[model samples]
Target chain A: MKKTINIPLGSQHISLLEPVRFKFECENEKIISVDSDVGFVHRGIERACTTKFKFDAIGYVVARVCGLCAITHSLSYTAAVEKLLGGEITKKAKYLRILLLELDRIHSHMLCLSHTCENAGFEAMFMRIMGDRELVMEIQELLTGNRVQFDYINIGGVNRDINSEVAKKIIENLYEVKQRVLGYMDEFTNNWSLSLKFKGIGALSLDDAYMFNAIGPLARASGLNIDVRNEIDYLPFNEVGFAMQTQSEGDINARNIVRLHEILNSILMCENVLSGLPEGAIFTKLKGKPNGEAIVRFEAPRGELMYYVKGNGSAMLERVRIKTPTFASIPVFSHIFVGENYADAPAILASFDPCLSCTAK
Target chain B: MFDLKKYRKKSPWILHYNAGSCNGCDIEILASLSPKYDLERFGVINTGNPKQSDIFLVTGPVTYRSRERLIELYTQMPEPKVVVAVGSCTCTGGVFRDMYNVEDGIDRYIPVDVYIAGCAVSPELIIDGVVKALDILEKKSKEMEKPLKLFKEAISENGVVNRRNVALKVGEVHEEN
Candidate 1:
C-alpha cells in the first residue's frame, strides 16, 4: 500500500497563536517533511524605528513589537545605540536593567514552562504553573508602571528607579517566589506523565541544533554554550555570580528542565543585583548624535538577541537590523518538527516559545 | 442537571490567539498562570491546538490580515467552544482602535462570549473571565441550539451547502429574530 498525508497550516494556524505557516507531510500522524512562511504581521518595525520614530521613542515601540520578548528588543536596541554614541549606562542603571531583564526572564520562562504542561496534556500542572507566574507580573507592574512594554530603559539609563522600600518588597517577593517555584519542580521535573510526554520529544541533536545555528535556550538545551550575557560580558551581569543551564539530550523535557532550573538562578541573580545595587543617577544625558555603526547583543529571555545600528550624526538612525533569537531558530524549528507526531507539533513549537511578532519585525 | 458547579470545578483548556495589538494583555494573560495569582487551581489551561481547547482566549484587536484566519481557526475548533476576549485590545481595539488596519475588536469578526477588561487585563480579571467563560460553556453544552451564525451569506452566494466564513464560523450566527 502507498499513501500520502498533507497537513497545511497557515501563518494563522490554530496551533500558532501568531501568524506563521507550516505544511507538514505526515506518515501515520508523524510529520515527515515540513515547510513554512512568515511575515504575516511584519509591521516594518525596523523601518519605522530608523526613519519615523525618534531614537528615544523607538525603544518603547521596539518593546511593543512582541510583548513576550519586548525587553530583549528594547535592551538590545539600547545597547547598540549606546555603543554608537559611545555612552555607557551607569553601573547602577546596568544593574537595574538586569533586575528588570531577569524579572522578564522569570515571567517568560514560567509561561513557556506552563505552556509545556498544556502541550503535554498536563492541564492541571499548566494551571499550577500559571498561578505561580502572577507574582512576577505583579512585580513588573509595580517596578516599571507597565506590565508588557515597560519602556523603562532609555538610550542611557532607565526611566524608573527602585527605592529601598520597593527593593525590599521585591527581595521578599523573590525569596517567597523562589520557595514557591522550587516547590513545584518535582511536579514539573519528576512527574512521569510530563517526563513521558516531554522526554525524547522534539529531539534537536547537537549537530542539528548547531548546523541550524540555533541560539539561546534552543541551543543551550542542545548543550551549546552561547549565552550573550556571558559572551559580551556586560558589567555587574558578568561580575554577578551566575551560570548557564544546559542539557545534553536537547529534547523537550530537557528544554523544560533547563528553563526551570535557570529560573532559580535568575531569581538569585536578581536578588543579588538588587541587594548590592549602587545608588547613582539613573541616567546620563547623551551629548552628541550617533555617528557610526555598532552592534550590541543581550541575552533576552529567549537567547542571544543582537541589534545592529547605523547612524549618520543625526537624530534619525540610518538603519536598524534586529536578529532575534526566534529568527535565528527558524531552521531549528523546521529541523526539529520533522518526525514528531502531528499532535506534538504545537508542543515542540511552544517549547521554543517562538515569538512571531519579534521575528516579523 | 449536569451540574455547572461541578463543571466549574473542572475548568477546560484554553487556546490563546493574538489577532493584533500591543502585547500588554498577552503578557499579563501569561502572568495569570505564573506563581502569584495562579489560575491553575481553577483548572484553566492554555492549549496550543483548537482540537483540545474548550475556550478561545484572544487578545488584541483583529486586523484585516488576521480576520479571515481567526475565523478559519474558529471554524476548525470542535463545538462547545467559548470565545473570551481577554484584553482592552481584543474587547474594544484599545489604543489601536483608531488604526485603519484594525477590525476594532475580535467581536467584529467573531462571536465573543465573554470579555475580560484591562488596558492589559490583570491576572485576577483573567481568572474571573475564565470562570465566566466556563459558566457560559456549561450552559452552552447543555443546550441543543445550533451555534450563532454571524454572517448572512457567504460572499460568493453560490448554490452550495456552505454559507459560513470558515469552520468555526460555520453555524455561529443567529437568524434575524
Candidate 2:
C-alpha cells in the first residue's frame, strides 16, 4: 500500500485569495506529491479580445484579466499595439507609465507580504502591514483615479498627466512608505516566525530554478539574476534607480526579502520619474489599425508578463495572447510542494504569490 | 438558552468564495477587514469553514469550472444566511458578460441578497455592502423563526379555544393568523 492520503487545498479555501486548487498526497504530515489546478478563474478574456473587442479597446479589456497587475496588462498591450503601428509615444507619457507601473508593483508586493504573514499565523503583522499598504494605495488612487484597475495606459499614451500638487502628494506618500518598508525590513530579518521559520522551508535550488525556467522574484530569490526590467529598454528602467534584487537561499525568507528590497527600489524609481519627467505632449494620436504581429514583455508585480497581439488592419484584432507570470510559475509551485510538511503548504504558497486570476485569464 | 438571533446580529462570520472574478474585489474585501476600514469592529471575521459562517461574500463572474464549487460552498452554509455579491462582474458579469467559459453572473447559480457593483469594489463600498448584509441576515433569521412561532400558536389555540372554534380557525391557520 502507498499509505498516502490526498488533501485538496483550494477552489474555496480561506488561505487563498483567488480560486486555485492543490491536491497534495501526504504520508502522515509530509507531502509526497503535489497536483494543482489553475483554471478556476478563467473567464475567456483572450478569446473576447479577438472576437468581441477592437484593438483600441483591448487595453481596457485586458486590464480586467487580473486587478493586481492591471497596469502591466494594459501597458504590454499598448506597447505591442504601438509596435504594430510603428508609432512613438512622447517621453513624458513613458515616464508617467513607469510611475504608475512602479506604484502598482509596490502595492502588489505589500499585499503578498501581508498574505505571507497571515499564513504564518502572525495576525498582528498581517494587520500592521495591510494598514501601511494603504499609503501606496492612496498614492495609486491619487495618480490614476482608481486603486485596483488603473486602466491608465492606452495605445498612443497615458490617459492622465501629473500636476505639481499631485506629484508633491505622491512624493510625500512614497517617503512615508519607504520609512515603513524599512521598519518591515527590520521585522522580516529579526522576527522569529517570519524570518527563522521560513529560512529553509520550500526552498528551490538554483539549478532547479534554471531547469524550471522560473521568473520574477521566485527565480531572483534563487540567485538567478534575470529581471524583465533589466532586459527591456523600451521603458527607461535603467535611467531610473532600478536595481535587480537577488538572494541565494531561495526559500520563503529570501522571497520575502527580495520583495521588500524590490519595493524600496520601486519607490526610488517612482521618485526618479517624478523628478526627471520630460516636457512633451502626453498623447500622440497614433492613427490606422494594427496590421502586424507584435510581442511585448513587461515586469509585473509577480514576474514577467508578455502579450502577443496580432492585427489584420481591421477594427478587431486577430489574436490577443497573454503569458502571465503566475501561469508560467505553476511548474515551480508543483515542484516545491513535494517533501515539505503539509502544514507549511499555505505559507509556502503565499510566499510564491501565485496570482491565479492572471494565470487563468 | 442560546439566542441565535442576538449573537448572529452581533457577530456574523463571513465565508468568501472566489467564483471567478479578477482579484480586485477580493483584496478590497481584505483591506476593509484590516485596520483602516476595520470591518472587524462590527464582529465580522472571514473564515474558511462554510458551516460556521453567516454571510457568503462571493466575488467574480461564475467561471465554467468554478460554478460547481461555488454552489457546494453555498449549500454548505447554514440557513438564514446572507449572500453578498461583490464587484460588477459577480453581479451581472460586468466585462465578462458574453465570455465563453463564464456563465455570466453568480445570481444564475446562487441567490444574492446584496450586490455591490464596481469594477473593483472599494473598501468603503465593501464595508457598506457588509453592513447591508447584516440587516438582511437579521431579517432572514426572523423569517426562519416564523414557522416555529406559527406551530406554537396552533398548540396554544388548541387549549384556549373549543374544538369547533379551532376547526373554524384551521382555514385561517394556513394564513398568517
Model 1 residue B5 lDDT score: 41
Clashes of each: 25, 1
Per-residue lDDT tens digits for candidate 2, residues B1-177, read: 998767889999999989888899999989999999999999999899999999999998998899888889989888988999999998898999999999888889778899999988999999999999999888888877875223323344546743343343445565644
* DockQ in order: 0.23, 0.84
Q: Candidate 1: which stretches are off by over 4 Å?
A: A9-16, B1-16, B30-58, B61-64, B71-119, B124-177
A1-361 per-residue lDDT for model 2 (tens digits)? 7698999998778899988889999999999999888888888899999889888888899999888989999999999999988999999999999999898899999999999999988999999999999998998888888989888988889888888999999999999999999999999898876765688999999999999999999999999999999989889999988898999999999999999999999999999999999998999999899998999999998899998988999999988899999889999999999999999999999999999989888
Q: Model 1: per-residue lDDT, tens digit, A1-361?
A: 6576888876644345577788889999889899887666555567667656767677776776778777778888887778777867788999988888889999889888877677666767876777767677668888988776677889889898788778878887888889877777776678777777788899988888778898888888889888877767655675666787888999988888788888999898998897788878999998788889988888888877888888888888888888878888888888888878998887888898887777765
Looking at model 2 chain B, report the run of 10 residues with the lowest lDDT sum: B147-156
TM-score of chain A of each: 0.96, 0.99
Worst 10-residue stretch by lDDT in candidate 1 chain B? Answer: B168-177
